[model samples]
Target: MKLLKLTLAVALICLVSCAEKGSRDTAEKETAVTEAPAEKAFKYWTWITADPERTDDSYQEEFAKYKDNGLDAVLINTNTDPELLGRLTPLARKAGLEVHAWLMAMNRPGDSVALQHPDWYAVSREGKSCFDHRPYVDYYQWLCPTRKASRNHVLGLVEGLAKVEGVASVHLDYIRFSDIFLPIGLLPKYDLEQEEELPEFDFCYCDVCVAEFEKIHHKNPREMENPALDIEWKQFRLNKIRAVVNDAYEIAHKHGKILTAAVFPYPEMADHMVRQRWDKWDIDVVLPMIYHNFYNEEIDWIGFATKQGVQDLKYKDTELHTGVYVPEMSPSEIKEAVQLAKENGAKGVSFFDGPALTDDMLQAIKETKEGR
Candidate 1:
């Protein structure tokens, strides 16, 4: 009986000790989960055009306003003037905002050097040059990416911007071909209906592009009955734009800067509309202008577009930042836009223009950043 009692006591003690060990294990797991790190905050940015005449103090004040309201970066369009960019970069940095040198890549209007060589401009399928016969607008003077001289000129500008001290990245805008199909919502404003590929809007049938395409494919795009149906012709233009971007990428990296661009909504849409396959290009970041209102889409469309771009870029290291048009957005709508961008996997959000953001909009942006 004494031996049996001793054995039972030992068993009871073992059972209690095991129970306590199990409880400690569960507590450790819970503690580990509670101590896990939180997700990183989303970045905010805005596009601003710099005026050389503006005083440095004014720019300091402007940049401070953006930084105070939660903007992490500013893309400044100085018309590809590196000197002006050099002057503004320190000001923005002093205000605690990253400065990006924005340049009009291919669509250079009133460019003194390019204007000197009229043949450098892209020609439409209708045999009209963008230099003399402006397409859609007077400022749509896109240079031929296929031409050695024209492409080099554009790259030189990129190099200039990349060399600017304190600049984060060389931001490229209008880097694609002229739009083959304007957005549906913009059609009414132009009083037009584009059911198919129109000749007037089709581009880069210039001598240089035509010769290069013919040399490689042994066919002439100009002689084809339906050039749009020719896969090689379409791919040729896409490759030309890609080559320019890839070259610019190398140039930017060589100068210790990254390459970023303001692209269309998504890869397929950008390809169909502007012959820009941004997903295939070698770029660091792409801020797709997902202006839903421009396409007659509702605010929720922002999420869909952002998700589409994110999915397309899943295999790439390129970061996608959703660019929203803020001129027409109300304060509530702005909040929803930012949240949609975040929920849809965008790394950040950028307003179209800095001057268009109102106080209420800035407040909305700030509150969203703070999770209020």
Candidate 2:
């Protein structure tokens, strides 16, 4: 009986000790999981205009500076020159930066091939072709997205860039109609007021666009007295832009690349101001140029705009990266802008231009990236 009791006691002790050990192991695993760091998904990007005249060594140095300061990607405007993009791609990749071929999609300022086709240019509501009259800026030589030739020309450029080795995306800039309403702060610079959609600024009333709209809606947009009030007319233009973007997306994917665009602030604002409804388009990423100073808005407006875009894209796979204008911002404001963008659910923040980022601004970005 004593031996049996001793055996039972030993078994009880072993069972309790094993249970305690199992509990301790579970606690250790739980602690480990609790202490494990979350993976960082936020990215940093910058827009840069590439100069063919610059030496490779110079570009290498520039790219290295951007990378060292926490930039992960660069949208390089090579003036739609795929060869230039191809030349710069490897160099940027060598410096640990992802390369994006940035093209001025609809606004082809001095496109040699496009300049040969005047009919492809967008016509204003006042019957002035952007081919010559050019809108508020001389560079606003936007093409009519509804025109097959012009759109194909733009898609061809996208395909050319997509073919470049190691390019992350074919970045389309100026993908919308020429702004019907200029930013409020910029209105003074242009010496004008935009209380209404001025005929001079309203666009794509070209014969092709008119005919296309008439065919679809059985009414001519040009015949409408107040075309701005015509919902179908506005929707037609918006759909035209969306079509171009969707086609570009397909072209990019065909070459195993993604399509990205530098768009206006948000869907509703974009549609109202520029006939662009980016949220409805098929794209991989949309970096909205939420430059608050352009609208005479406060810094916190960046967060507001970022959150708006993020909410609009909640169901989309398209990522939103808030694009900030660094030229007018101080170092402290830069940090605040980055934090606001993060807090508002931006996947990343991109500076307007790489050259505009001062050392202090870069340091601010670096520190913000390091969580310092």
Candidate 3:
């Protein structure tokens, strides 16, 4: 909404009814010199992930083959190794591809910060001492957003990458709370009652959060007593995390780079799972992970979810890049999914991971440039 307001002000600046292309060329050149990769504005995209510290011989060979297929970009998940980035930057450029640095957010690697600092994990509402993984669905722990050290580390990594040349954007993943949910039926083994009351569907009543809540709202959320019943506080918590990522956008843009994030399929999924307020942020781009096999068996589900994301979050002139699950679907399906996204106002689609990619899928990707 705020963006729409700003857009209206800019619209009034243009009074021309006819083109003055020669005069505008000088201004376009200045903008290009200032805005590097983000200003280029990719049209269609896909990706490939390299193995961790493994030799890149095969990776390079595949990329060489990829050069002819017309991939707009690749998402590389390199934890550190600035030297690897140096090599990768040129390799990707040689193949005529844009690069997005895919870095882990809250889901810290075992040997990474989370293992050394257990304080980073968010505690659940039941007073259980554990990480914020889906209440009963998963086994992993996610970092608490309120903690400055962990949050700083995540942002620092992005800031480091923003300095990399030819890197269009820093693609962030796991940008919010751990996946949290309650399973369908209570297990009889745990002696749980069939009609027993559960707190809220997912997430967090950690001591730190409770203390912070009391300080801010002067009441406990559990007493205000629920997410469905007390939706306001839930949104407040979402805003707290949103502020961190939104702040990261400021850091990126200051360096003339774009801040992009991969979020869940829908707003409900985002709010229920991690309290991510995607609708509010001014992120340069949003790649909603449209992993639909987890939703239903419908073949058309990917396109449907992509549209929902574009409709719900994207603003006019804002880019939407659909995250296609390359390993799970057929080649033709991948191609069709990309096409569906384009038709429904998406700027591009990105493959989730790159190494599992097949040549047939690359062939299908070439068809996306048909009308271009």
Candidate 4:
């Protein structure tokens, strides 16, 4: 009887203990769920070109203005100059700013590597290579993403920049095929209708890409009646670029650095235009070039584009920073754009460049920074 009584008493104690433990666990989970997440930080960044005058002293002078205006980072097109990066790192850090290596990945303008391997340049559907005949822009010399040599050449540049001391991140630009469909505003200037996919602008029909596509589907892309409508072929090109970008992401993460890209405003439209499926690219952050004027869009389009990118990345870990072109925009217009970006869930905002910005534009950016 004593043993039975003792067993019942122990079971009762255990029941009470388990109930208390369960209540505590529920309370803890409730606290965790209700606790507010840390506020997202607002960052300001701008792009700069490293001209001959951008020496150590000049760099210091340039960074001082950025620091004074509450800028947090600067993306500089430093090429593969480790020496210059070595010099600029401490200076930028001293000025309370971070330096990101701005690199042109697929678009290698005057690239000595591409110059040597002329076959590495992407060929249009019309059998024209970017090497001999430049695309819409004289400098739009794009490399074929499927070629092993092209991948190695670009990755070598990225790896070198990653090894640079104090480079906060490697910002990739022009990491897409030449635009198959130019923006509507640009079409008039280029004298293109582009109601349908034009053979001249469509690209990446180089020997390697052709052979691979044929091997996959047992068909040639060039023979397709409407190559643009060939979803499999289009996905092939998208995957090729995605592979290169993923390799870059791995390289950056392996060295403990962030990998970012300057992408087109909308993923679906970007896919149709540039074959840049950046939504699938494994990147830490993306700065969509949400330049309204380029797209012939209004100021409010900034919010819409930013919101679209945010929604696309809602399931991913990537952060979005909207890139604003400040050339033709007024100070008030710029402020409104920044507000739109913030309201639409942008973590930060980046201006297209530093050299083009005037005092008024800078003051407007300052106003945005001060929350005025």
Candidate 5:
């Protein structure tokens, strides 16, 4: 009877041990599946500037809010203030969040380098410099990409930002021409009907651009009755922007930094309105600002725009991140946006600015992180 009892106890112990081993094996397999190749983890990030946050002593507390909210990264505009960045980067790293330096590439308002060379300013079809005329927006002081000085100046700024330690990436913003054709929804605010491209908004007809176009086509674009109808003239401007972006990409790569841009949502629309052919840019990541309200689009349009960008980048090595404006979104809407972005092959979702991160939005983001 004693031997039988001992045998039964040993059998029970072996059975439990085997069960535990099987559970571990199952867990390992599950982990392997979750970490499978080509399967990227979703990245949730936000954009902020260092002016008040970095200068004040409350930056640590401000950064803590982002870390606690399950944010994978933060894109901060240091305003090219290296000392401010140097101070803020370590704080972000300590909180386990990646930090990116957001810098304006072509749109330099009151930029001393550009101010010194007035000819570097982009020109309108009506012979106006964006510097003096200040079209549409007062801060639309865009530099001409056709000039060697302009390219060199942008590259120098990129190099400075990329070399800063703890900066995981460098974000390029406002890298395109001014909105020649505002989004249909926004045209009303400007009190303009964009049924036709107006000369007042058409851009970059500077001396360098005109001379280059004439040199290639053996004709002056300014003399054309309707330059907007000319594809070659548009392509010329697109190529100039692309050249500056590619050069900046090379500079970022030289410093072993990732290059990313916040571009218009729809590639075709962007090309037509702003001459931003972002699809051709050779960068690591592209964040298309899928702000539906700005375009008078429905929530479903986010998925459509995201899918288009994903399709455009299918063959390329670039990753797509859908950028949403927080003011127009609710917590439920935020969750829906993330789901749609993932459904359309987007690797992640980003918000335009940080202040708009409300409690409900943070809750939705938390649920997203938990796979809820």
Candidate 6:
């Protein structure tokens, strides 16, 4: 009877222990299942370097730090380097960061390619086929977008970048006309040979572009805008840009990757400065560089302009990301701008991106999220 009692007690204890263990296991799983998703993060892009390791000596180390400090994505200008990207993909994955290829679509050849293919260059208003060295700037040349050769070169480059494994997106920058903002000076530079009486509307009136435009419109822009150019002819110049952007979209979409553009803030600035029709293209995302200081009085106009650009461009459904110069303002002020963008219906904002990312700024992003 004593042995029987002892055996029964041991069996009861084992049953209770098993039940308790099962309960603990269930509680742990429930706790884990209840954890929320990570906070949506801000994206970053670099226009300077093509190599990400050159981006920071320790790529993984820097991303781990950013992860700890809080940043969502990093876009490096590596659209030209598939082999290098091959090595960097594993590094980005290990660090838990999204990688992007930054392409200078129309802005070609800082030195090498332009020097080799001089004929591929755009012809300026003065009819200069090969651009003489500019006064202070280092950028030598840009390929004429209307040319099939130029278009193919850019498309091929993008396709190569698209093949890079682990690239989340391909970012198009300078995907427009030359951002040469001449003062529309009251008078042409005297001593300048054969200056026209009309204001120089800087642009790409390349031979190929002119031919395509004439085929579509049956008129020349110079003659119409010259009072000699009709409103329709002037508008045709803007349409050419849309054609290029749409072409790029087809290629990028076919590959199953998202296409995003870096554009100027206002609709007019986009059209005037770079001929980028932000309100037209159905890109996955559009990032307008609304550097308030650069726009002068247009500072207060940022929110309204962005909202209009988003809606007028028929991109109300598209993701909106504003590019801000982080160093120009205080964190609170930056936070207010982001709030303004969000209130005006932007999905998120991206900083111009060299700032140290102060704790206050992170808090502001946090606040922006909570307020939404």
Cα displacement (angstroms), candidate 1, residue 95, comes to 0.7
Candidate 1 residue lDDT tens string, 3-108: 9999999999999999999999999999999998976568899999999999999999999999999999999999999999999999999999988999899999
Clashing pairs in 4: none
Model 2 gets an lDDT of 0.94
TM-score of each: 0.90, 0.91, 0.78, 0.90, 0.89, 0.74
Error of 5 at 282 (Å): 0.9
Report the C-alpha lDDT of model 6 over 135-214, residue by residue, as the tens digit.
Answer: 11446356677777776777777777777778777778877766545222211432233233233324555677677778
lDDT of 4 by residue, 240-343 (tens): 98999999999988877899999999788789899988889899999999999988899999999999999998899999999999888988998998999999
lDDT of 3 by residue, 1-372 (tens): 999988886775553422456558878998888886654443655555555565566666666666677677777777744456656877777777777777677666553556677666766666553443444446455666776776786778778877887788877787876554322222443344433336533455666777787898787865655444576677767876787788788888887889888888766767775677676776888888776665544557667777777787545444678887778788888777877787776777777666666888777877666642
Q: Model 1: which residue pairs collide? A: none
Which residue window of length 10 is worst by lDDT in model 5? 51-60
Q: Which 10 consecutive positions of candidate 3 have the poorest summed lDDT?
A: 181-190
Better lDDT candidate (1, 5): 1
lDDT digits (tens) for residues 1-372 of candidate 5: 999999999999999999999999999999999888875789999998777443444777777888788788989887776677777888888888898989988889988778988888988888999889988888889888888888789889988989889888889999899888887788788788778877878888888889989999888988999888888988998998889889889988888889999999967878987899988988899999999998889999999999998888778898999999988789999999999999998999998778889978988988988898
- Candidate 5, which segments miss by more than 4 Å at Cα? 1-38, 52-57
> Where in model 4 is the C-alpha error above 4 Å?
1-37
The model with the greater lDDT, 1 or 4, is: 1
Ranking by lDDT: 1, 2, 4, 5, 3, 6
Model 5 lDDT, full chain set: 0.87
Q: Which candidate leads the pack in lDDT?
A: 1
The CA lDDT of each predicted structure is 0.95, 0.94, 0.68, 0.89, 0.87, 0.64
The total of clashing pairs for model 6 equals: 8
lDDT of 4: 0.89
Which runs in model 2 stand beyond 4 Å of their true positions?
1-40
